[model samples]
Target: MKQVNVFLCLTVTFQMKWLINHGKNSWGIHSMSKNLDIMVKHLTRVEGHGNIVVNMKDGVLEKAQLDIVEAPRYFEAMLKGRSFHEAAIITSRICGICSLGHQMTSLKATEDALGLEISTQTELLRKLLIHGATIQSNILHIYFLVAPDLLGAPSVFPLIPTHKDVILRALRMKRMANDIGDIVSGRAVHPITPVPGGFTQIPSVGELKEIRRQLVEDGIPDMMETVKTLASVAHMIPNFTRETEYISLKHPDEYALYDGDIFSSDTGPAPDSDYLKMTNEFVVTHSTSKHCKHSRSSYMVGALARWNNNYKQLCENALKAADSLGLKPNCNNPYMNTIAQAVEVQHCIENAISIIDTLLDRGLKDEKPNQEPTRYGKGVGSNEVPRGILYHEYEYDRKGNIIAANCIIPTGQNLGNIDDDMKKLVPEIVDRPKEEITLHLEMLVRAYDPCISCSVHFLDVTFVE
Candidate 1:
């Protein structure tokens, strides 16, 4: 009992020291002689790079700038002349992490242009594939990427030594989840199996049976254990109970992932067409990414929002697991997102299992293959990516060539909230040393799981002049 107290005390001391390492300066430092502006480009150590600049006035945050300097891939520009089938492939390459979500949206758009509605068998398969993507992305976000900071581990690699079994199970499960997405969507990174009308290739009975077998054999057990373990780790983070308005897709019958109506804490079910109206974005001089404000103001989405909006839609197994940890719908604590991600994984496996079983029950082992559809018209599509709502609007000429395209990425939609979060976060964490500010800012963005790399991506940090 005495040892526990010592450990607790030490943890608190370390947190305090980290938070105030950067001295408080109400005014930023500046040199005279025309205030030389140094062009210091922040080198991003992660896979995607963005930049942030801060002007400090006597140690106070005078200005913070975020930029996605990376040239916007002329993706939208490139889509003008491709076939609908080809455009789907091109769009899928936009984000490595969210390739499947893009695939589903682009395909749905193509189907709209062609006026095709697919079979239930195909729809169920798509649901399984996309849900697998969600599980894969969410688990990656929760365990390896997000948990390290909250638990005070520099990286997942370090945790392996102290918590070998727990970390290994998480890695293995995340790999398996990605594999499930790969099988149905095409590949884990960028799959082409989904087509404008349906899948380029349908699954064989044997293949689906194998997927089903593993769904129960390994998926549920791994996820259930994950929820139990991560919940324990989450209790250690400092000041994690900040409440924010939650937003996500809502379905009447189930927790919406791939298909559902939109819902949020501040509003009831919104028609799909009303999405853009709700997420009104405006530009800010300090950053290149468009800032978003909801109908009322800024709001947040992703796993936490979805879980809160649709907790009642969760299956029995998932609800029991979440409730075991004292989690419920309308959970406002943003820090609870990782737990929500884990809980959603449990629910995803269950949903996939149900979908597979439904397909198998039809008695028609393997369904028909995808062929170009005869229908043609304009269409809009949406699916929930790991981060938030992803929308696609497509137009085609009578000959089946693409004419216009619009895609609203989840990361883009979350920009306003991301900015607002930093507004609150910088002051909370800025008391720490200047060098440590970057790490704290990184944590804030990681919490939102932003995936965009601008031609010159925007990053925010307080800097001295």
Candidate 2:
């Protein structure tokens, strides 16, 4: 066994060397040796466990896939027989990073199923909370996960010594964003105040004004610095593009975060009720997380998708930030997702301030939640979370107990697209060093800002005939 292992290692080494020498073709063309294997057992700096597996033999691409190794969380099954009141609370545990997103989406599903109507004030506050969540999550991704690659560091830890100011700015922005969630939603990680119909607690007028002041005095300046920082390292982002469908929630009045219809860049708008049709989820042998495709083999559903589908809805400041960061509309490069996230940080800050001003003008309302259900049946809810568009569907009985549930996280939707990108990217960059190739693959996966644990809800069942 030892001798065989040695022979295998030597063969792989020789093949890599040969590829480095011979493989160099024009971009997007398979001009490499196409004889390599990469098994990143557990990728790092992302929210959950995922592996990048690629194999090419004899100039034919064999397999390129992001294998989700995380066990199935079964959040859907957990919701069965649960009460409408507990749905959001339970589903929010799916991810700590995206807990607020899950909570809000779950609440939307519950309210829709129970025919609960929320007040206008409730809508405004929820939008504020969403903006906070988006800001927090996007800033976290931009600084903690992706910055290390661009700055030539192993992780944010190493940069602490050299890039202390940059790191400090990241922490300050994150703290401010979390403060918004904490004040409005009752906590940042797993919000406690927001319920099916409305918030259990409302921020005072003083609190709203304070948040607005902080946004203007601190958030805006920090965001400007962030854009400059990202722009400095923008050249490090890979220049790769594979045109594919982009999907996100599209709102008519503003950039869709709290709610919108399902919009696809390829086929245009579809009702949120037709999400299953838009997703077209199917199982793949390579991944435990079910893959989704619509209007193509795969479609992306994160910041870049939102930018492509809803760029016109962005405020003027966000548009300027995009221009500064070189994030143009209709961008197909997956790496630009990080850039898009930065742009969103700017948007969320600006939007959050506007929401606060509106709330202040309307005066604080201490209205109780409307829990009286007119009906109970099927409903669906979706939001463009930090990672991408998240979905929750539920059916409730007359007694308000959940009968069935399904959740489609953005990470699951992006898995197939990541795989597709890998197939194209590996061939295009196969001539580079193996380490460089592996780094590119890792960066590509990180570009999606995937939350693997949130996505691994697929369970395969077989029956004995």
Candidate 3:
């Protein structure tokens, strides 16, 4: 067994390739179709640590599981007893990739607890920020992480040589998205301006106009090229499909990524307060993270879910991108998640422009955020984050201090669905070569874009006699 690791300075990316040769009769065994115990100590290309284990004995499947070994982050414990004003700042540390999502959701829950209201300008700015983060995250996942698999390469580093232009295009789009976040929230990665009720500092009309210009000139053109790039490799994606429930926030006027009612394909729309009933999380022994279910054994969330529930609400350009890419509503293939994300990137870019136009027309306001808390109570804030529907629930005391905090991340909710998918996928490909089986499984998980770091929070281990 040999391993090679490559680091690309251009993209700040690292990828690993394994070279294993189990020579015939090396271990007194000659048949490749014998009993097997395949254990992947660590998976690659994802945000954090996880393992995939599949077992089979003489052609009979035994076990297939995604084992998450990351330690619990205990972010909820850190929130307890903290002031309402600091919730967003503290929760932002949960994930660097989705820091803006955490901050916005935290602020919404905190503001609701104190009965605070924000201005129209603030809401418009927040919507732009969400779009920016969505674009940034989706581009990173599709090009840097998943594209290599489709191109039959071990990592994106190899693609850089053959597909240099595609790599550059991806970087350009990512930079523009990050700039949008920086302009609105004061920084891209863990935003600084947005607070409980509003932004501490808002962009000027001039800045808004400039961003709109960029979105119109550069963002849209690049998205068209991106759609073409992905469509060229659409055939590389597996055609497997499994009908399951899709959940996301849905709004009547527009595709909901910022705020809306919880809508499930299995059921209809429900209030955000009923998130607990929607996300019925339970423990699984193979993983440290909890798996969630709603209206079935498992359900999916994220860009694909959003598309399934709110496809009609997408902007004209986004709808066109979907049609061109052959990505449609109720797309049951998990592998199409990457395609959905790409479609969303285009949608978010157009929506950001519309939001900026609205802000410019309304004119910038210098009003400070609402800091006064009329009363303390329980509040739940739900938003369609990059990964999926994220819920932040808080119970505040009279003095505006947190009594309890519960955050249900999108990745945590998708673990069960991934497990179920794996159980079905392994059987279909069990007769093939081991390397092929492993690659397919990896592709399936990457399609979900699982953030192991964000998935592992507090967990209670129980024993049964």
For every candidate, C-alpha RMSD to the true structure in Å: 9.9, 8.6, 8.8
Local lDDT at 191 for model 3: 98
**Best-fitting candidate, measured by lDDT?**
2
Local lDDT at 152 for model 1? 71
TM-score of each: 0.82, 0.90, 0.88
Clashes of 3: 0
How many clashes (backbone N, Cα, C below 3 Å) per candidate? 37, 0, 0
What C-alpha lDDT do the candidate models reach, one value each?
0.65, 0.79, 0.77
lDDT of model 2, residue 347: 88
Cand. 3 TM to true fold = 0.88
After superposition, the stretches of candidate 2 with alpha carbons farther than 4 Å from their true spots are: 1-34, 44-49, 452-465
Residues 165-272, candidate 3, lDDT per residue (tens digit)?
Answer: 999989989999998988888899999999998989988777778888888999999999999888899999987788889999998888998889999999999999
User: What's the best-to-worst order under TM-score?
Assistant: 2, 3, 1
User: Which scores better on lDDT, 1 or 2?
Assistant: 2
Q: Per-residue CA lDDT of candidate 1, range 69-102, in tens?
A: 4434556677877787697788887777788888
